[model samples]
Target: MTPNPPAVPRARLPLRAADLRGLSRLGVDAVVGVTDVVEAMHHTIASVPGIVGPAPAGRPSGITGFVYRTVRATTRTVGRGLDALWAAVPFDTTASTPEREAFVAALNGVWGDHLADTGNPLAITVSLRVGGRPYREALATPTGRLLVLVHGLAMNDLQWTRRGHDHGQALARDLGFSPVYLHYNSGRHVSQNGRAFAELLDELVAGWPVPVEELVILGHSLGGLVARSACHLGAARPWMKALSRLVFLGTPHHGAPLERGGRLVDAALGLSPYAAPLARLGKARSAGITDLRFGNLQDADWQHRDRHSQTRDDRAPTPLPAGVATYLVAATKAGRPIGLHGATAGDGLVPLASALGEHRSPALALKVPASHRLVVASANHWDLLDRPEVYRKLRSWLR
Candidate 1:
């Protein structure tokens, strides 16, 4: 009798293996970036006639050129060999874990453009997920009421279920609304992602198996900015008619203090010629990170200017959509005796005023009525995701 076929070794997940390759590429790029910085410093110093003279105008000897070429060719060959080896290995897509997926999403949020342009395996494509499956397959029948949950920077849809609970799942079970999680590369420009998201929603609505009755969006942190951006761009789309409510959780409507501080660091580094090259390190953060400096949601906000420049907040005001119920949730670390200072201090990353859309300029301020705003005391930022009290407030509003 023929013995059972030898058991096959389970292959690693494609993305997990690809992450290794992506990291290798990042190492190569880091080496190249350092070399470029050093070369630039050399050029800057040599150009100063008083301090240093330019080298004689002569090409390197044929032997030196050959050596350089050989080194470059060897490097390229090794890189290619590694890539080929990774490609040859089989991968089980089912092995993709939530932790690995979240880590990759964060990397994409930081260096997504590079990954997309180079067709790297680390780039995440935006899609709607239902029951942990792609929308197309999972959403066979539409439950009129739809709730879309968008995650913050360096996060993925899987991250929504935090500490044994997810607002989306609870809302669906409690309110009979269908919950959909958005997966996207958080590293891309907010406006760019916004536009794509608007288009994607338009298609989603049009393709629904059943009529869509009401649509609600719950966005956290930077996700709120993206949601607002999409609404601005898709104001005239048919799907807008179905949009009923928008809820922002710990979102920075004006800007985040962390990114603004990064800008200050970049400017300080630029003050010294010797240290200017180091500024590139700060500026190397993804466009998504830079856009947070002023909560930029439109292309005009960043179009032609130096993104790293210490410029005034010139982002065009994007007011909340009319006819839609807008809600703001701001969290603070301090409890009961929460004074103005504690409120302004916010949940550590976002200030209370910013989260509440309190801009000095009326034109830029989001007109969310006092009744629609909720402040969670003694809660940090991430707590907004799974706190029982927070869920109670959401249920009250959405119900």
Candidate 2:
């Protein structure tokens, strides 16, 4: 018998030193925040006079100050030592597991922009994935048609394959279209992600190995909002010329009721003097979560205002692109008896009206024709990914 070849080692998730650093920073911020809150509470209890309170007593001059300085120096030294130790460990950068990716995606969805801004190791850079590898490395040949799939909040690109079925792979096999999944930090504002996506798409199109003839986009939830934002921002770019169709899967075009409810809770907490400090806890939600309150798609929607304040829906209406064919898919939990509750409850996350873009204001309405709209009964928001009917509808549209 021939000698057996050596078994290949299974790839392990890389040790990310940045995660430790980011966590350390977050811990520091939390401690500082608590300190500030405690100080404020003490001041409130003391009933200090004037808008600006008097400064506290001066620092200790001798032994106490020396001891304080030594403690501070020791803490700094320990932190630096930990950082150095982590950095020295060799880590395989490319070895990442799906579970880890999902966790990071959720974390990024909550604090992605902040992480990216601070150069945190956990920040996910937006990119296309093909054959379980980065697109640039794996895509040696390209097809004429491209189908780009964008996932919802707190979701990674790997999640597209639900119950062993991925719409992108299905489309690729059935229609001969190339499928590219976007991996991004969902914690950033929709407009910020949109702008980055616009630039990335332009670069991608320019660098494509094959001449791109058509481009189609499928977005789920917040991903749809990001796609819409990209379209608005990329109107003048060359890549816009290749755009042909855009489909939304349970997108909250109008806004999400859950976020609105959260905002109400925050506002209520702030109304009472005793609960005012507790309001800060509510306000700790990421910028991305706040943007969901009004399905904000443009920078102007949030650039000037306080994101946590109970503000009216001031978002400028962004109509669907003139030439592109647009489609909407809404999901309802009820199978039969699709009555008020079924319609209003809306897949438990998004209401049917919002998913269908049925705004009372004509200016804000998406204008997707009735023929282009689909409603999946007995399905929740996430069910849109793997449901057979949803797949059939997608096939019919793209066919």
User: Tens digit of lDDT per residue, candidate 1, span 79-147?
Assistant: 778888877767746556775776788898788866777777777888888755797787654688988
Off by over 4 Å in 1: 1-15, 42-77, 139-141, 336-338
Q: In model 2, state the lDDT of residue 123.
A: 83
* Root-mean-square deviation per candidate: 6.3, 6.1
| Model 2: CA > 4 A from native | 1-15, 48-81
TM-score of each: 0.87, 0.87
Give candidate 2's whole-model lDDT. Answer: 0.82
Q: What is the overall TM-score of model 2 with all chains considered together?
A: 0.87
- Lowest lDDT 10-mer window, candidate 2? 49-58
| TM-score, model 1 to reference | 0.87
lDDT of 2 by residue, 1-399 (tens): 999999999755444666666666555455555644554444444444344333233344467556555655665566667667767766646566786677788889877777788677778888878745788887655798888898999898889999999999899888888988888889899998899888888988888889998999999999999999999988999889999999999999998998898889988766654455566777877777888898999999899898988469878999898899999999998874268987897989899989999888898988788999999888999999999988899999998
* Candidate 1 minimal-lDDT segment of 10 residues: 51-60
